[model samples]
Target: MVAEADVSGKEAAALIFTYGTLKRNFSNHPLLQDLILNGDASFIGTYRTVQNYPLVCGPYRVPFLLNIPGSGQSVHGELYSVSTDGLSRMDELEGTSRGHYERLPIKVVPSGEEMEAKITCAEAYYAHGSYAMEMWKKNGKQGLKCYTENETIGYVKRKDRPQHLTFLDHIRLFLSD
Candidate 1:
């Protein structure tokens, strides 16, 4: 569900669990440059990140939440008090209209709070299953590791061909952060 605006930034901040192309310097994340410039945003390093492909799993599906159950290791990202307009744009970019993904309620680590705060979370459409395990076996540790480390995303080098298709090629390259 979309969170009510009654919750202020100090009370809560929206959390987006980005395990794939949403990381900075990757795609249209530049549009969110205001967050970095305004000083209202900060990188919170305390959420789990995971990588998944919709084409392989199924069309228009959010990747299953992995790494931690409710909360876990910090998935590298920044949190900001985006304007309602900015958020509306994000919702559209995230394909919130599609049944595959939705903005559910979640807790974000406030800038200087002891506990997580209430916020909206974009979550996957399916039950948490063993897709990560399958990916690990399919790509081995190196490919899986590369995907997770936020290094050389979008493209995966082929071990045999030395040149090959990558995640970017197979999927719709994310157009927004």
Candidate 2:
């Protein structure tokens, strides 16, 4: 059987849920805009996860959808349909290989239509499994109903952060900030 990550739109586009920076007008939206302009992705609509999930910010104010199921709020986000190449690019951007994030299945329904709408399972990027729990602890165990960090203290892009520091080092810098 083909691995889930390898299964893509040879025939059908994959559904994706964006809970943080990838949402419209958020920090990382330019990438999605490029995908849309190139016809690699299409916006489905505003959607929210069916179950509660912790949404927190780590170093550089990066939003993390913690993998701890049923622990936070029914987070709202955007949904999209992406072609194979689109999925691949998103996976790369999310750093699945580097363990920055992991793509996992999540159930979402149209925003404001929860009980009346059909639930759809889409793939969403979450905090890396190895550090998710620890990250939550570092964030004072706080959970936001939505990801709106860009308006206050903003996210620093990975490229802009110090190139040589380990993630733990960055975490230290973040705490000091």
Candidate 3:
């Protein structure tokens, strides 16, 4: 069910769990905010993944929630109810069409509790399986349950990155230092 919708009968169609740049105050949050402003989405609340997943940084300090479970920590992030159009917009931005990220159903629970037995089903963008493992390995196999905005290594916005290189190439260059 749509958590919230607009007056014109356009209702949210999906629950999205956001754990990276799309979260509020992050580089790509403007897109999500736009949807919210236009009444195509509504913030549900903060939640933590029901299972552990590798949340790691890759090219340009971009965060990737690797689908490999039971290896990292249960990710903490915000949830949003999104209209079909809003989900499409986010899909494009996340590069789902180009395989940079893939939308997958995940289980989450509201935060600030003692791990409730009840779990909510939501969809989240995870790094594509084709390359997620390799990227995690290249990044020293480290992961975080929550992606802190003030990363110790720093974060780079998309516009600031070199336009000539593909994202995978950027991944290779990310840890050269």
Q: Which ten residues in a row have the lowest lDDT in candidate 1?
A: 54-63
Worst lDDT run of 10 residues, candidate 2, spans 1-10
Model 1 misplaced regions, further than 4 Å: 1-19, 34-74, 110-177
Best-to-worst lDDT order: 3, 2, 1
State the lDDT at 90 in candidate 2.
93
Q: What does the lDDT come to for candidate 2?
A: 0.81
Alpha carbon lDDT of each predicted model: 0.36, 0.81, 0.83
| Per-residue lDDT of 71 in model 3 | 75
Q: lDDT tens string, model 2, 115-171?
A: 568988888999888778887787777787788754337678878888999665775
- Weakest lDDT window of 10 consecutive positions for candidate 3: 1-10
- Top TM-score model: 3
Q: Rank order by TM-score, top first?
A: 3, 2, 1
Q: Which stretches of candidate 2 lie over 4 Å from their true place?
A: 1-11, 149-152, 166-177
Candidate 2: residue 113 Cα off by (Å): 1.2
Better of 1 and 3 by lDDT: 3
Q: Write the per-residue lDDT of candidate 1 for residues 1-177, one digit (tens) a residue.
A: 333222235222343444443445544355455543543233334342232232122112222223223322333333334445555555655545643245543443433334444332433222123243333233232222112333443343223322464333323322111
Model 3 error, position 125 (Å): 0.4
lDDT of 3 at 151: 60
Which is superior by TM-score, 1 or 2? Answer: 2
Q: How close is candidate 3 to the true structure, as a TM-score?
A: 0.89
